[model samples]
Target: MSLTRLLFTAAASVAVLAAVPAGAHADTGPYRMPPPPFGSPDAPGADRLTVSVVDSGNGNDGTYELECGPAGGSHPDPRAACGRLDELAAAGQDPFAPVPAGTYCTMQYGGSATAHVTGTWHGRSVDASYKLTDGCEISRWNRLTPVLPATAP
Candidate 1:
């Protein structure tokens, strides 16, 4: 395979691996993977977010209210979504982080689905947009899974 193809494959592999359950350890090498989270994080005041799918092929086109730290709201599955977010946070990964600069993305198209997420997370304000325009974007969307919807490649 060409160097470029190999790099793309590696990046894609990374993306796939990133979709692993949040409770999975991020460490590499000899570190042993631990069991899934058995305890819930203490519920604080209210960390809320609103997810609006501007365009969707599935029934998820409407808006949803998500409340974490206690995991209650209009979101389809607040517990799972909040658990996913908790896992990401514990792994030191920002679920809403943007695609890094200059990162090459595959030309593969995921879909025309568009989403806008707004509210406060981790005590910080958040307003992010999501689109399944390319490979990286799709992976990012999938990373949030049911929080968004596993409707992409």
Candidate 2:
């Protein structure tokens, strides 16, 4: 092949390689989301709030999915929560993990029972606090919200 042709081919190959997806060249390593937070209010007949942790893959950039509901009731899906986590991750913020460590929820159920959640990412943890009120209000269980870093005591 002519020297000019070889050079052009090599440059084209380099550009193609560079355009490949990052995961294709990246090392396939295990990425984990933080554990769920603790704490729940009293309920009737096993009516306890539960939080679940989901691994959203490396695409989430160390974000997590937190789903919660009544202990005996069906739990909410983690996709919405995962989406929220992705947004936070994109903003260069780790919302799933908090500094001090703990689960937090910002849900306000118009009932007597409340649920709280906390998630961890990259060794950090974040929390949300939930409070129940009256009526049948929809509690923010599967939605992703801002997770504030806990202040040092």
Candidate 3:
């Protein structure tokens, strides 16, 4: 091609490249934009929970994704689970609060089941685990029943 034409093309290409956003070349995997912060005014679908239960002895184990604020997910009963969570939040208590100090707990062994719950509730993060080892722990585990798979009696 002519020298002038080549020079014009090269300059135009450089200008176009400089106009592009720096993030345009970033490789942030699937999500191009960072996920919205939970409870942020601009965040949608931020109130959600992922729950998992494991009971090797009883063969009762499953994982469920539960959403609140509108109460939707693969959970068996989103409404009930959300209601329970709302109750806990309304009372300003953590659903997975440790056995209170000086509280009496029976010495009976409950069972061999473990559960994990992680998600956002009331815009706050929740990463809790439950095990049925003692009376108090059993009760805590029971409170999240249905959200976490219920152990066979």
Candidate 4:
């Protein structure tokens, strides 16, 4: 299988694994969104972000809310996303850094999916875009797996 397919499969797996049970019932009407697994309203400098992805070519689009310092959000895998960010912070790496030039990549057209993440995290503002237009971009996109949907909307 191709690397792109492998990355997609891994992301899909994460999403499925992180899914929470819906507590909806007839008495409650629509399902009440679950409280976050971590973090609290009173916590100082709690992280919050609004993430979105749009692929006009393939009609994949979605927007979700993300809060960390205790992962919680509409994001499919909040814990993983937050963990990635934390790892970057720990290593002094920039999550939004441009993929290095001349990096070897296959000439594969994964998709035209484009995603953007905005909001605050780790006490800093975030405004980032992700795409799968080429190998380097695909690598970057994969790093954000499960945060952005793997399939077209």
Candidate 5:
């Protein structure tokens, strides 16, 4: 091949290689589900609850819904309090990182209650729980509380 033609072909190949998307460059490996929410169940003054997040990889964003109740009673839907996870992801924020470590009030009589969350993640469903202290005021279900590395499973 002529020197000029050879050089042109090499440069074109390099350019095409560079144009590939970064994510495409690497295999994301197997799709591993995120760890479950971490927190103690109930203490002397602590109420326990579960919080699960389903990472729906669907381009439409994810949803976070919660059902809460007392330690041994029927659970009620508290979806309104849990807010939308997809919205947080859109805002570039960790969707589950604001659930405070305390008690929360039930959506009904403003009574104390525990929390159970269910959502979709990477097209999969997730469910977790949380126990709050007595007389806890669940004004609003913030993002999932920060899970300490030591406590994560």
Candidate 6:
């Protein structure tokens, strides 16, 4: 290539580089964009779920509607359930997230209880199931304690 053309290309590259602020390449910080209101359960479209249990030895088998923010519904303890959900979210954990695939869980059996939760939480869809079949499953069910009745078989 001609020296003049190569020099022109170099100068153009330098100009482009100089146009960007140095801090642009540096790690300014974690996601600067404001995040969803995980702390505010009362926010619209927050917690509105339905929990259903079948064959649960605890005798709490039945579907119950749950609403948060104002905290109302057929749920026995909307306040407590909402509190648990908010707490988990604030801790950077998704209370309704399923156990990861291939994860090892204890073979111990919790019970025959099986529960399903379906609805929207913090503007996200949730369709989680709970069963007392293994340690991980039991823990997942227990984490939502009041949401899902403390079942035993």
TM-score of each: 0.68, 0.27, 0.62, 0.58, 0.26, 0.72
> Which has the higher TM-score value, candidate number 5 or candidate number 6?
6
Off by over 4 Å in 1: 1-45
Q: Report the C-alpha lDDT of model 2 over 28-147, residue by residue, as the tens digit.
A: 666785443322122112212234322222122222234323112233434444445556555655343322334354444433333355543323344544433422122232233322
In the order shown, the candidates' Cα RMSDs to the true structure are: 20.5, 17.0, 11.5, 24.7, 16.2, 6.8
Off by over 4 Å in 3: 1-45, 56-60, 100-104
Task: List the candidate numbers ranked by TM-score, top first.
Answer: 6, 1, 3, 4, 2, 5
Model 5 clashes, total count: 32
Q: How should the candidates be ordered by lDDT, best one leading? A: 6, 1, 3, 4, 2, 5
Tens-place lDDT digits, model 1, residues 1-153: 999999999999999998987667766446675533322243233579999885667767789999987899999899999888888878868889889999999999888898888997775677989998998998999898778865633
Tens digits of per-residue lDDT for model 3, 112-145? 7888888877656788988878888878877766
Model 4 has a clash total of 0
Clashing pairs in 6: 42-69
lDDT of 5 at 95: 40
lDDT of 4 by residue, 90-127 (tens): 66666766777877877776777888888865545679
Highest TM-score model number:
6
TM-score of 2: 0.27
Between prediction 1 and prediction 2, the one with superior lDDT is 1
Please report how far candidate 5 places residue 135 from its true position, in Å.
12
Please list the residue runs of candidate 2 whose C-alpha ends up more than 4 Å from where it truly belongs after superposition.
1-75, 92-113, 132-153
Give candidate 1's TM-score. Answer: 0.68
The regions of model 4 sitting more than 4 angstroms off are 1-44, 56-60, 100-106, 151-153
* Model 1, position 56: C-alpha lDDT score: 65
- Candidate 6 local distance difference test against the native: 0.84
